[model samples]
Target: MNDEDHYCENCDMDLYGISPIYVDYMDLPYCSIDCLAERNTYKKYKTIEEANREAEKNRYRKEEK
Candidate 1:
């Protein structure tokens, strides 16, 4: 397990000591499959092509308040 507090790219939960699930675009690491699914849902996309088409939009949508 990585000692660094690598948080879930989706929910931003601390992902210490847990295995990470990485995506391809930015190689972002997620905490779990559920978190990965939630992220895709948040992007309102089921395919990488669609997500890439509006990557900026998804990025803006997931920005921290």
Candidate 2:
């Protein structure tokens, strides 16, 4: 496939538009930070669920104040 046709491995979304956040893992392209996190479980990187939970917590904290 051509460079323009590259898509994210996890979400299957077109990669060109969000290329800034693109990550390469084992020669595959991921389109977003979250997509990269979802695929890799290395140190200091949060999983999708952990990121979502943190976001939810921040949202609730905002609602309380």
Candidate 3:
């Protein structure tokens, strides 16, 4: 997606200029780890590292399939 399309799913904030933009397991963008956690109530992630670990696991599983 282009810069115009990069926005946080939770707050709808522009993510184009933001460095280290957070993304969920589903590849949805967020302005911060807090916003990522807020949007994904089903998953409990205390930090970005936790979220990234889960995402990496899921990615491997998908690739294996």
RMSD of each: 11.5, 6.8, 8.7
Q: Which segments of model 1 are wrong by more than 4 Å?
A: 1-5, 45-65
Instruction: Put down candidate 1 lDDT per residue, 1-65, tens digits, no spaces.
Output: 34444888778888776778988676688988988877876678767667677877778888954
Cα displacement (angstroms), candidate 1, residue 30, comes to: 0.6
TM-scores, in order shown? 0.53, 0.42, 0.47
Candidate 1's TM-score: 0.53
Worst 10 residues of 2 by lDDT: 17-26
For model 3, residues 1-65, the per-residue Cα lDDT tens digits are 55545888788888876753546455566788877667675357877677789899999999998
Alpha-carbon lDDT, every model: 0.76, 0.67, 0.72
Model 3, stretches more than 4 Å misplaced? Answer: 1-5, 42-65
Clashing pairs in 2: none
Flag regions of model 2 displaced more than 4 Å: 1-5, 20-25, 41-65
Backbone clashes, candidate 1: 0
Error of 1 at 34 (Å): 0.9
Between prediction 1 and prediction 2, the one with superior TM-score is: 1
Per-model clash counts, in order, read 0, 0, 0
Best by TM-score: 1
